[model samples]
Target: MTTQFSALFPGLDNPLILKRYPDSSDANLQAWDAADEHLLKHLDESGMLPRRWLVINDSFGALTCALRARHGDTPIDFAADGRTAHLGALENLQSNSLCQQEIHFHDCSQLQSLGNDAAILMKLPKNLNFFADTLSQLSQTLRAGQQVLIGAKAKHINQSLLTLIGKNLGEANASLAWKKTRVIVVTADGKPRPLSKPNRWPVPELGLILENHSNVFAANKLDIGARLMLDNLPVGDFSQVIDLGCGNGVLGLQTARLYPNANVHFVDESAMAVASAMANWALNKLNPDLGKFHWDDCLSHLDAGISADLVLCNPPFHQGEAITDHIAWQMFNDAKRSLKPGGLLHIVGNRHLGYHVKLKRLFGNCKTIASNGKFVILQSVA
Candidate 1:
């Protein structure tokens, strides 16, 4: 796919390069939306040059990359949870041959330690609860009068988001729309805002309580697909197990409990999901070292020589706001490559997704393990 970018200001185009998918595919579907451009333009017009700046949730590195490009070697720090964002940002930076030495990277969980002098530029995340948590964290670090600017599509910048920002941070104001995008500029009042705790729910029969963060999938309850997969776990003893696209790490934790001697790997693309899984794993008293938690896009960064005897997956059919099976396709392919000879790939998916056809084509064999009206559990043995 072609790397396409749009500059909101003169000499300040945001670089966007799609990875792991061809440009000819549905990949070039607006990397930086009008909201991103509007935010950049606002920053340029304001000429508010803070010595240190923090950017959060800059999807595809657009905001961070553009800021660095405009400032020309200014120090900027970026925080994000998704492995894809980190990889994409690095790729975009390299593609543009931009000097990235001054850019600092931090995990989403470490936002509390950031300096108050840093101006926070954030993209309104799709999950409001996560957005609230981010704001709450900012509340702790930001002093009175410090500003946090948030950009989002005009349609998404509703009163609720603005209210949440005000409730968590301080007084907030929205700027006039540009290119159908609006920026909410919020100043810190130095009023302490309590962060939301992870949601806890019990799995009655399993006798396990799962703790999920707001951004985690099926946060308040067990996913029906995951419940079916848990009930139909393969009978064989598996030494090396992988829970691909593990949400809240329910599947991986169950596997760990069932096989205390086995090593279980939890892999997901969401930062909050991985954080929840790690917390739940600790809460359940599972040894942290026994479960390898990866905030990754499927198993892309997983050790290449490491092979799993059993790979359990509830592959996501979408990425961000787009509904597509490309991720599921990639997950299955990665599972096949990561499995040892005669290893098995177990998956639960919506029945209409036609995962059987994809598995059949990839592994030359597919079998139904279980099925409900809306979900199907399938298995493919290498």
Candidate 2:
């Protein structure tokens, strides 16, 4: 895979050659999209300078890097909820030979003060609830006249979305389409709405209570695949266990409950997922010493010299809008790498995904431990 790809913006000194953060082999996919281009264009054309500016949800560093290149040394606040996206931005900054000191990065969970004079530049996220939560938080930070410029695909920018923005921030409208994208201009009214709380649910059978932040998958309840995996945890006297791609840490929490002596590691790419997992682990009153949480792309950043006796996963088939097996493949490969010899990797996946084939290829042996009509549980020894 190529380490560098270029994105061009009008009036810029150089085309930004950037890589997807966390560096994937998928060269066909880009770090930024047309909506990102449209946002930068609008920001440039308007020539609206504010006392402060914040960029949110930039998939990589496209918007922030371009802004730094054009407006040299200007301080910008960048907020992202995914560790991969945050890491990607940092990598892109260095790749483009830009000053990393020009931008301040913030975890979406822990936003700092933006003051009242700030203007916001944002790429509309796929999840509306997460968007709303962001706006709610911003409403408190911005003043009555501060504007929030939002970039989105033309089809996704509609009355309902506009109303949502209006309800959460202030009055909102969109510009005419460009590059099949539109920019929603929101004026903050200084009316702060309550940030939406993470959804909490109970698993009566497992005696586990799960709390999920807005962006976490299966926020409302246990996933069917997870339910199946929980029901059929691999029988082992495992010492170290990993819940790969653990959404809310349910699997890890259960692992702690079932195997009191095992050290359970919870890992995920989403910062919110990692935070939620940590919170759920605490909420469940599990052995605090036995729990470890990582906000990581995969096991790539997991602690060195740590091998797990068992790894549990319910691999996600998609990342953002792209429906692909790349993540699942990566998870399986990472699990294999992180497992001790003779250790087991147990996973639940959609039957149609045919994860058994990948596991068999990786481990040279795979077996179906359990299955139903839609999901299958497969295990491999490393």
Candidate 3:
């Protein structure tokens, strides 16, 4: 694949390169989007000198790298929940030979101390609830009259996003479209707005109450895939279990209760997901010491020798706006690598995803545990 980049900026380009797995012959997509370029251009035109800048949700480090290159010696603090984004940013910076010392990276959950002088540059996230939560966090850190610039595709920068910004922060205005991208400028009003509470609802038959933040999948209801997996939970003395893409931690929490002796590991790529899972775990009075939470890309960089006896997963089929099974492939591979001998991997997927095929290839044996109209539960032994 060609590493084509915007000529307007010399050092910035899409650096997070990976082919869509299981379909390697398919074209690799660019990591950075046009919205990233618009934000960089807005920064240039505003003559914004390097103050403490906070860049949020920068996919593949396009904005952060470009800003660093343009304002060399200026400090930029980058925050993202995705491990891939963090790693990709670092790799891109290195490829451009930029000093890493000037850039600060933070996990999304620990963003309380960003300075008052910090000018915020954000990419509108796909999840509006998560987006709103981020705005609430910004409201706490920003001083009155501070500028916050948000970049998004013109289609996504609608009245609703602007309304959310105005309600939570201060008044917001959108810039003229440039290459079908728009920059939204919001000024902090110094008045603190109440953040939206996580949604909690009952699953009556299961005798469980689940909580989810706005951006989580199936926030309003239990997902069909998860339901299928719940019904097909393996019958074994699972002493250590992991919910690999544990969105709301429902699967892990249930596993923890069912196998009281087991330690549950909850992992997801979203900071908000991790936060919600932690909250739900506490809300259910699950032993904090019994569960380990990691915001990660699959199980990459997890502690070695920390294999699990059973792993539950409902792997995501897409990454960002691109629809691909690469993440699911990675999840399956990671499960295989992290399971002890004779350990089990239980998974639920859309019927058409054909996870059985992938599991069969990875584990050398795959069993259909249960199936409904649109979802299926599959099992593999390591």
List, residue by residue over 1-382, the lDDT tens digit for candidate 2. 6656788885596799977765667766778888888888898889876666688888888888888888887788889888778888988888788998858888787543663565688889899888988888887778788888999999998889989998998999889999999998898898888878998999899888999998898988789999999889988798999999998999888888889999999999888898899999989988888898898888888987889999999998877776778888988999999999999999999999889999999999999999999999999999
Order of candidates by lDDT, top first?
2, 1, 3
Stretches of candidate 2 exceeding 4 Å from the true structure: none
Q: Per-residue alpha-carbon lDDT of model 3 for 1-382, expressed as tens digits? A: 3343433453345332321212223355665777877887787788777567889888777777777766676788899877778877887777667778878898665555674677789998898877877787777878899888999999888787789889878899999998899999998988766767889988876777888876677797888888878887888988889899998898998888898878898998876688788888888888878988988878987788688999999999888888778788889999999999999999888899988988888889999988989988888999
Candidate closer to the true structure by TM-score (higher is better), 2 or 3: 2
Instruction: Give the whole-model CA lDDT for all candidates, comma-separated.
Output: 0.83, 0.86, 0.80
* Root-mean-square deviation per candidate: 2.3, 1.6, 3.0
Q: Quote each prediction's TM-score.
A: 0.93, 0.96, 0.91
Give the distance in Å from residue 358's predicted Cα in candidate 3 to where it truly belongs: 1.7
> Largest lDDT belongs to which candidate?
2
